[model samples]
Target: MFVSRLLAMCFLCVLAAGGTVAWKQRNVTIDDKHGDEVTGIAPKYLPSHAWSSGPRDGLNAKPNASLAYNGTWHDSTHWVNNDQIIVNFGFTGVSVYVYCIIANTPPGPFFDAFANYHILLDGVFVGEYRHDVEMIPDYFYNVPVYVNTTMQNEFHNLSLVANSTERAVLLLFDYATYTVVEEDPVVASTSTDTAAPTSCSLLPTTDQPTGNSQTQIEVIVQVGAALGILAFFVLVGAVIFHLNKKSRTPVLPGTTLRHISRVPRHLATFYRKIVRSLTSHPGESGGVVGDKSSVAQVRSQNKD
Candidate 1:
């Protein structure tokens, strides 16, 4: 039974590996379009704002707007194709403004609708906008739009397309500015076994004063040393107290008597015999008679 289970597990692992390989081999395709011309795309009478060749032609196309007149124009029949603007530089997002100068006309039909316009990036359709503007006669209109795209590649192609036939002369293209957006890198924080310092202040992040601050390891070592020193002093005090108490206590009377009894028997006997002889023979020989005579003579002299 165990062998069979092991074989089944191995087969499942092989199937999973094959599935992963197949998924990696799959490819995705993106659809794109190009622009070809910018002829009189801007009216001859209006001032030139900004213009670039469409994708249909290479870099050989000329700037369509004439900078001669400071005035700009916008009409229902005029339109400009920006399909040829190359965005070889890398970017994550962009903002474009199409400035229009219109004559006396109240909110006349113009390129204010975003649905009629869209932006492309790297041959991929990215975004579209529809804005509205009601202009008074002889006033200028500034139309701005924004598009966001991914920066998957270094070089990219961008184009603006007008879905409506409405014409509007572009005075200036405020320059295309790009912002680089990147995902913050993932950093997996790991814990270490090393001891970190403990802060004494309410705020843990605040720096400690230079003197007398304790690190974690130092605190532990100091506490251990203090306990050891206290224990040593306590032991020393106990020994001294024991010696003092022993010295103050008197020796037992019974123990002193026992020690005296253990003295040499001959020396004790000899001391007793000498004491007896002195008491028995008080005044005994010729020296005793001579002493008595001298005593009598001294008494007679004192009387006289």
Candidate 2:
């Protein structure tokens, strides 16, 4: 029983240690974003762009193709289409800007610049920006936009369109990207279906109570064994004492002789009485004295 208990305790200790280790190792982290536009982007980095068209040729100028450039001056406005751009990076937030620019001196007929614009994502129209009255050099209108789409599998379309009869120019595209990371789910170290030893349940649920119980049982068993041994020794000692007492009890030499002597005294008295009673009888004879002498001799020999 003691050996079995020792093994069970060791097993339980090992299980507890293993569980602790497993729990410590059970954690998750979001690695990175998962789309296309994040080509040169670091784990959490965002991309930016800015561009412009010349004043004289703005009417025929094309929108800037570079991802980093926004737009500038022009006779006719051009649109920058980010609709095909998808940020593969794992991010939850997106910020976009639409800038309208007008210069002070124009080559000939530069109409007062004014325009309306709209933002789109995944073919769904989200928001719109309208600027009707505008004029002057480096005069620029900025529209700040924000969107929250926590998770995405592919590139999301982002775009801005200009609706203007007068010539309009875009000077900047300020983009700020943000990511919202979700907390990893928690995991248990051990399965609920795992079987534990029965002894684990037998262990004291409380330290003090268990300790007291163990102490009490140990004390009781120790006391009982001690008492049992003591009793056994006491019985053995008593037997030995009796044997010693019996052996040591005084024994007189010639005890039979002493008893015989007392018997002779009693017999002599009896013989004397018999003789006196016989002497008082007139019919007593010498043969009776001879018969009495023979009986006395036989009694004395039997007593010896």
Candidate 3:
């Protein structure tokens, strides 16, 4: 039994060591030029009355070498004092990154040039960033302003807000990119016999479980089943060992057999001897003695 338990523990350890599954990853980019046109993920700007309708010309507007995602971006006219751009997107991956542009500035020690911004995910504040003039000298296009790598793989609400309104700090929102974990396609089993087709709804898949959650569930079920099987085998082994040991044991004797062996044994015999006058006594129909004592008396009488 002890050996069986040890074997079971080793088996469980092996399963735990090799239970991990490798998942693939990819990146999905959403450009700011077509924000409103996109389905289900349009960026909604707070206080809609303060923004412009089209991209207006600005100082050194174009990137150095077509660096912006898809050669398009939203200028600083889109957002101003305390304005927030909110987006609700679905992902099945690890990280999310926010990109923007910094327009060219004149030679001066203006404190407004150093802008401050805040990022929030799922209505919780994650972090913030400040644009420094010494670090970023000239007009920098398509740069990462805010990045968050610690988000669960699910549908989330992201908010990008301007924290500083000093002299209307320039904020060029270009695009955003999120890391996506691509799942391997499941191969369908085919049969020769024909079957009826199934129906599926053409609705959004935001409510469905992602690959990460599904994989985790599968692993849990598999481990539970394995443990159950191990327990069953261990119980069976213990029962068999008990039965074998009982069969090989010796049984003790009872009191009735001992009493029968203790009973005594006696001997029986016949004597045919007579004295000198016994011949005549025989003719007179002599009676025989009933026990050994009479025989002894007769012998004594003959002797007298």
Candidate 4:
């Protein structure tokens, strides 16, 4: 039992360590204008001239102070074809997020306009996002169009493609964010010429997601599970120990000389008197001087 309790405490300590690890990881953002980190290509059916990139405020619109890093974004304007603008990026993390400038209830012929985009993770369709007409605000900058929190901590591919045919559709991408687990820094005795790449762009070919992030709920659940397993083992061990200790004590099957020796002297004497009275013949009320049958029977039983 003591050993089990000690193990349970150790298990709890491990869970605390896991929670600390989860908390240490932080989100890293990658801007859409990072040409080397992200790839933006239009469908072959569409001409290259349709693609454009510039400052978000260049359209005589003010930048939302609380949103959009650097006020720079990528978009395609005045395209009517079904060709989609696909954005591809590679990151090393457990979760991914895509931010874009989406419009809802815009003026002109697009008052009820809506846009759709298909999200693919690692070449497989994960989900789709639809910026419906009923969505709040006229424009949403730096809004998360896609979020995927459940993923393994490794190098992964993410793709976002415009899927709508509406002329009012807006795929104004601003940035992308993902989470990576933090690794403990290794200290070397001497410095080297090579250094680690700090950006997600370098992750695809040169580096891996050594540091990853986790959701609060996932961390809580992991800790809870560890504690549950600890409790179960502790209870089982305690019960088994108790039973084993109890089994070691001998239990007599019937009354024997050893058992009588364990009893008090007064109790043993009283018990012997009762036995003698029961064995005495009914004809003999007084002390037996010579009763052959009774004496022989009692003596034989005592000898046995």
Which candidate number has the best lDDT? 4
lDDT of 2 at 54: 35
Over 19-96, each residue of candidate 4 has an lDDT whose tens digit, in order, gives 332234667777766532433322121234545565544442233535666567766543357566777778878898
Model 1 scores a TM of: 0.34
Which candidate, 1 or 2, has the higher lDDT? 2
Residue 18 displacement in candidate 2 (angstroms): 12
> By lDDT, highest first, what's the ranking?
4, 3, 2, 1
Q: Which ten residues in a row have the lowest lDDT in candidate 3?
A: 265-274
The segments of candidate 4 whose C-alpha lies over 4 angstroms from its true place after superposition are: 1-24, 35-48, 56-66, 77-80, 105-113, 134-137, 166-168, 185-304
Candidate 3, residues 1-304: lDDT per residue as tens digits? 4356446656755544444345787777766756522243545555455433224453334444366666665544322455554333433457888887665553244323445567877788888867665544566766787787877777666777664645445455677778767565432223335432222322215577445545666898999999999999999999999999999975433343344345442110112233222332333434442445556766675566
Residue-level lDDT for 66 in candidate 1: 43
- lDDT at 177, model 1: 36
Assess each prediction's global lDDT (C-alpha) against the native: 0.38, 0.43, 0.56, 0.62
C-alpha displacement of 95 in model 1, angstroms? 11
lDDT of 1 by residue, 1-304 (tens): 4356446656755554343222111111111112111211221211123333222243221133242122222222224443222222222233222232222332224433112445666677777654433443333223345444335434445555443445442222222333333343322223355433221232223355323233544777999999999999999999999999999997754555455557687444443333333333336532343255545644565456
Instruction: Give me the runs in candidate 1 sitting further than 4 Å from their true place.
Output: 1-116, 136-144, 147-153, 165-172, 179-232, 244-250, 253-262, 265-304
TM-score of 4: 0.46
In Å, residue 290's CA in model 1 sits off its true spot by 43
- Report lDDT (Cα) of residue 256, candidate 3: 34
User: C-alpha displacement of 73 in model 3, angstroms?
Assistant: 1.4
Which candidate would rank higher by lDDT, 1 or 3?
A: 3
- The local distance difference test score of model 1 is 0.38
